[model samples]
Target: MALSGEDAGETIDIVEPAVRMGSYLAEVQPVEDAAGLIFLLWAIQQPTIARPNAFVRQSSMELRLDACGHQITIVQTPSSMSNPGVTGAVMWDSGIVLTKFLESAVDSGRLVLQGSKVVELGSGCGLVGCAAALLGARVVLTDLPDRLKLLKKNVEVNVKERNARGSAEVCELNWGDDLDAELTEPPPDFVVGSDVVYSEAAVVDLLSTLRQLSASCTTIFLAGELRNDAVLEYFLEAAMEDFLIGHVDQSQWHPDYRSQRVAILVLVKK
Candidate 1:
C-alpha cells in the first residue's frame, strides 16, 4: 500500500508485513492526523502473521529541501532497532526536523549557510550535514569510528554526486577526545547536531567537544527527540555553564515538520 499527503508531497510504500503497526508508528511518529488515521486503517487490514521472505534489509529515505531545490537520498540500514549499538545506521525524525529547520532558516534569512564552515556531530546518515552542504556551507560530518562507513557513503551519494554548492567530508569524532587541528583550526561558523544527547554520561563529553569546537562567533544548533527529560535537563544545565542557550520556538520551525516531541536549541559560547 502507498500513503501520500499534501503537505509532504511524497508517497510512502508500506512493504513490510512482518512489521507491526506500532513499529510503523514509531518510524513516523508525530505524523499529522490524516496520515495517522490512514496508517491505522492500513494496519487493521494486515494479517497477524507476516509472510515469509517479506523483510527488506535496506532502504533509502528521500528529503526534498525547498531552499536548495534538491532531493537528497540517504541509504539506511533497516535493522537499526536490532543493532542498538549502531543507532546511526538509520535516519531519525529529529534529524529530519533539523534539516528542514535549516532550510527554512536559510530561506527566511534568519541564518546564513552560504560559504560558512560547519561541523555536524553524530551525523547519522549524514542527512543534516548533506542538507547544509547543499545549502552552500562547507561541512564536516563527524561520528564514531564504526558509523563513518555508512556516513561516508551517504555523503558521497548525496553531496558529492550531486555536486553540492558547498562540500562535505566525513570524519571520525569521539566525544571527549582531543579534536584534530584541522577540525578546530579557526573554529567553525556553525556546529550542528541532531539526536546527539541521549545519556547522562555522554552529556559531559558532548559539552567538552562543543566547547572545543566553538568560538565567540560560532553558533550551535542542536535538535533532539524529547525522550528523556532528565537527560535533556542534565545536558541543558551542564551546557549553560559555558554558553548562552536558548530554545528555537516551534513557531520558527518548518510548518509541516513541527512536533511537540522534538526541540531545537541555539547556543553560543560565552
Candidate 2:
C-alpha cells in the first residue's frame, strides 16, 4: 500500500493492477486510485516481482528543463528486467527526474565534469548518459547483462540525437563481477546511482562495489528516492569510512501530488 499521508493515516492499497507492455518505449507511472495502488502493493508483496516497470503505468517523469533550456526527447523501453519500477527504481521522483537533474547538474558545471570518465550504475534507459554525452563528457551506461540487451536497444533508440551530436559507450557492468575490464577504460572519476539502496544488504554491496570500481579518493554522486531516510542514513554511515557525505537532497511530493520537491545530500571522497 502506498502511504498517501502519515498525518492523515491514509494508505493507497495498490497491490494488483493490470499489467501490459505496449509499444517498445512508452513511459512509467504510478497508481491512480487507492484500490489500484493497493493492488500494486499486494503485487509487490510477492517475491516474484523482482522487476517492476509501470506494468500498469499511470505517471511519468518530464525531461524538459525550462531553466537550463535543454531539450531532449527520451523514449523508454518496456518495464521488465532493467526498469525496476519501484519508487527508487522507476518512480517519477526517483528515476527519470532525479537522473535528469543529476545530468543537468553535471552539465551546468555544478558537479565539475571537465574530464571525468563517468559510470552510471543501474542505468535503466541510459537517459543520464544521453545528457552527459551532450556536454562532451564520456559516460558509460552500465546495468546487468540481461538488462543490457534492452539497455543497448534503448540507447540505440532514444539517443539518436545524442549519438549524432557526440559519443558515449554502452556496456555491461555487474556490481562486483568485472568492473575494470568490462568498461575497458580508466577508473571512473566518479560513480553515480539513483534509488539503488533498496534492501539492507544491497546498500552494503553498493559501497563495496564502488570501493572496488573507483579510486581511493574517487568522487561519487548518488540521488536516492528517500523512501526512508534510514536508507540514506545507512549508506552515509557506511560510506563515511571511504568518503565524506557531502550534500544530500531530500524531496517530498506536494500535497496535491502535482510536483516533487527535492532535498539532496552530496558526498565527497576524503
- For each candidate in turn, the TM-score is 0.76, 0.61
Off by over 4 Å in 1: 1-67
Residue ranges of candidate 2 with Cα displaced over 4 Å: 1-70, 77-91, 103-108, 160-166, 182-185, 248-263
Error of 2 at 260 (Å): 5.8
lDDT of 1 by residue, 1-270 (tens): 344334367654423222211101111222123233233233432322323212112354443334366877778776654775777777777787899888887887777889999999999788899999999999999999888988898889888998788999998999999999878987898999998999998999999999999987688888877666667767777876887655555677888776655667777787
The lowest-lDDT stretch of 10 consecutive residues in candidate 1 is 20-29
Give the TM-score (vs. native) of candidate 2. 0.61
- Clashing residue pairs, backbone N/CA/C < 3 A, model 1: none
lDDT (tens digit, per residue) of candidate 2 on 53-80? 2122324432332211245544433333
